[model samples]
Target: MLTLQRRQLVGHDILLARHGNHISTMRVDRQAGRVVAYLDDGSVDSAPNLITPGLPMPATVRSVLREDWKFFAVATACTTGFAGVMVAAAVALAGLSGEPGMTQLLSAYSGT
Candidate 1:
């Protein structure tokens, strides 16, 4: 069984389960305001209540595996590191280009 501490956020916040051993049981972030969840594959999954927008919120997470919930702390750390890299890239691009280009970047390397 899982146990999660309820969270409150004004904007987007993602939380994954500490336990990822079971692929069948999906971990999720219970959306209250503008929050949404991202799976391991980087796909989004929101609580049905969030999708409805005005309807009563259903309990998305029945139980939080105390063990599984802890793993989320690690995910959050990784996200932080990635965000730092993104910020540095954005800054470098701005410095070099003076503006964000509208063009999409094509891959430089092709598969064999």
Candidate 2:
């Protein structure tokens, strides 16, 4: 007969089981809400939940970037630059508008 053991930790859960001569391990990350299973046959399976917004990357992307992480570095740099530009634009627009634009538009509409 095979037996299964389970352990619950603060931020994760682990399961261990044996079938015949093979042992399987499973881990669940509570924060990420993801599950990974390592089968006795040397196979790995993962299930990721959508606690965060954004589309999941395809398997092909992982395969292509497996050896080269410079792509990710460049991507991060581009994202940071884009965010900075957006913030600057917002600040400039706020400064340009201030209270004068609103007061002028209201006075014109009210005929005062």
Which is the leading candidate under TM-score? 2
Estimated TM-score per prediction?
A: 0.30, 0.32
Give the per-residue lDDT of model 2 (tens digit) for 5-26.
3322322222232232343766
Clashing pairs in 1: 2-64, 2-65, 3-64, 3-65, 18-68, 18-69, 19-68
Worst 10 residues of 2 by lDDT: 9-18
What lDDT does candidate 2 reach at residue 46? Answer: 57
**Tens digits of per-residue lDDT for model 1, 1-112:** 3334454332222233421432233333444344355455656554332434575332335344443676788899999999898867756665666334521232122458
Residue 66 in candidate 2, Cα distance off native in Å: 4.8
Candidate 1 residue-wise lDDT at 97? 64
Q: Candidate 1 — number of clashing residue pairs? A: 7
Would you list the C-alpha lDDT of every candidate in the order shown? 0.47, 0.55
Error of 1 at 97 (Å): 2.8
TM-score of 2: 0.32
